[model samples]
Target chain A: MPSTTSTRPGGRSARVRAAVHHAVEELLSENPAEAVTLPLIAARAGVHPTTVYRRWGSLAELLSEVATSRFSGDIVVPDSGSLREDLERWAIDVSTDLSDPDTVALMRATLGSAAEGGCACVGDRHAQLDAMLERERSRGGKAPGVQTAADALLSPLYYRALFTTEPMEPGWVRGLVRNLLR
Target chain B: MPSTTSTRPGGRSARVRAAVHHAVEELLSENPAEAVTLPLIAARAGVHPTTVYRRWGSLAELLSEVATSRFSGDIVVPDSGSLREDLERWAIDVSTDLSDPDTVALMRATLGSAAEGGCACVGDRHAQLDAMLERERSRGGKAPGVQTAADALLSPLYYRALFTTEPMEPGWVRGLVRNLLR
Candidate 1:
């Protein structure tokens, strides 16, 4: 009974979650998946397969967990009071983050499952952007609507990362922000 | 000896090509692929599987062919004598085309094989944009660079098509064009 309640912070459950996530990231980065499986990740993480299955339920969910952690939690959304400054910084951060091979890999996996309902990553970004835009409106500052901001700012970044070879050019994001807000 | 050149217009090779493409479009629209195999397509088209494999080499190449035929050749890039008008027309054309379920299915397939070198569909759009931009420059009309045009116009269309449920709003595309130009 005590052990059942022991799935607390820094406890065995926390350790398992962390280890599985680390293993998933490592496996995803190690190569384009020739089938990155639940058992493979479990073995890499040194947790029992059932533990991962019982907790995450599937590979897609596990991949999504890792992605959600990074996109929604780890990456900071800027709040510099100016919409242009905030958007430029945010776009640049996104471009930088997506430049990582692992992120690109994760996106490839998610985008398929994501196609039906829309990308969770996009939802997270849309939420972050909505908050920033709301703040700008409250401060009596002019800002584009969320969809406009997403189209002008975010879509290009994701499009480049997923579908094109070109890097997001230096200072281009600032220019995009300037052009958009103007 | 004449058989070698039988790929001429309306010949057996042309017929086969048409049939195969028709089959692919039909099959793609039929379902999210539980693996849209060469064999399945060949059977549907009444062409030999070897014919599909020989002509297209792989499923990825076949998918690209279907995509290229639509995006580059079928979908006309406009020339309205004004850069803004041309861009708006082109953007609206793209938004309309990608709204189809079949294109979405094709995109899902291409995006995976396309990750390393960039999507062929994107290349087609870039080339079309470049052609239009070059024409604008020749006419002494100021236009954004091809990459800028792609970022401003094409990326948003494809991004929303592939990654979101929201329809490309009726007048919103025109507004996007004006905003980007400004």
Candidate 2:
């Protein structure tokens, strides 16, 4: 069993956690992901090595936590009255997030590794979408088939981000939402 | 400059080519792609080290070529009576192909490295799709918007294959096509 650093009785616990996460993001942004290690992260964060090791157990787990926590903030489901408008806004926001080089590298790192925890962020986002669609269904609106709509609208931005250098242009996002609704 | 083995006029030349491609497929199927190398591939292929080196200067380039050639066989554009029908068939076939473990590994390999040639295969498939849509438009069918349709139908398969462990069930494929058309 690992020591419970998050629950430890120290005023510095929260600061240490924030510093570690920020260090991970900055390292990922400036250097290759493979070069990042717990010791390196600890050194960058000004935390002790034993504390980092005790908390995370492994680099993959640490990265997984970082990815999930960082991206959970980005998955806010828009409730703009219409599913179409909501999807349009969601896709554009996601595209903007993926456009950042650091975000792209983080996604690439998560995909390259066999970390199940890394995909937890995407799963959370999916759940948010499902809830939105459920709300629409309860409102006497026809079921928009949210999973299929997500596949159609969201997958392309990911495809382009991972497979090509194509920009996820605003026009493309709008057209994708329009076509899915049509 | 690397020697042109493909242009060499010998019975062994073709045999060597097939063996190398088969070896690459076997290695990818069994091992982590990062651990694969030209020397190991030559050993597995039973071709000379110089030959593998001569043809592909780096592991990334070799893997990219393997990915492109293997997937090219999977991109058959169906010409059914209607765009909807054609899309349905294509989606199902692509889904089936992506279901194969070997095909999945090959895609994972290509994506783990920076290989522009690896993406050429997908580009070719997109072109085939574009041509099919163009033909439909010429036949007095409303322009079934090639890029948007591609995002709707194709990107989902790739996304699910890479991002999730979910089985691309046949019922799911049918439902996706129906929803897109609706």
Give the winner by DockQ. 1
Q: Kindly give the number of clashing pairs for every candidate.
A: 0, 0
Chain B only, TM-score of each candidate:
0.90, 0.86
DockQ of 1: 0.44
Tens digit of per-residue lDDT, candidate 1, span A1-182: 67675577888888999999898788877754434678999999999999999998877677667777767755678988788788878888888988887887777665543335466556488888888889999999887898888888888888888888888864877877876787
**Predicted structure with the largest TM-score when compared to the true one:** 1
Give me the chain B TM-score of candidate 1: 0.90
Could you estimate the TM-score for every candidate? 0.84, 0.81
RMSD (CA, Å), each prediction: 3.3, 4.0
Clashing pairs in 2: none
The DockQ of each candidate is: 0.44, 0.32
Candidate 2 per-residue lDDT, tens place, B10-102, comes to 656778878988999998888766566689999999989999998777666776787778767556788877977787788888899888877
lDDT of 2 by residue, A4-100 (tens): 7656655467788789989988987776555567899999999998999998887666767777887786667899988777777888888898778
lDDT tens readout by residue for model 1, B1-182: 59676668888888999999899888877754434678999999999999999999977788778777756765687988988788778878878888887778777656544335466665477887888889989998787887778788887888888778888875978987887678
lDDT of the candidates, in the order given: 0.77, 0.73
Tell me how far the alpha carbon of residue B79 in candidate 2 is from the true structure, in angstroms, after superposition. Answer: 3.2
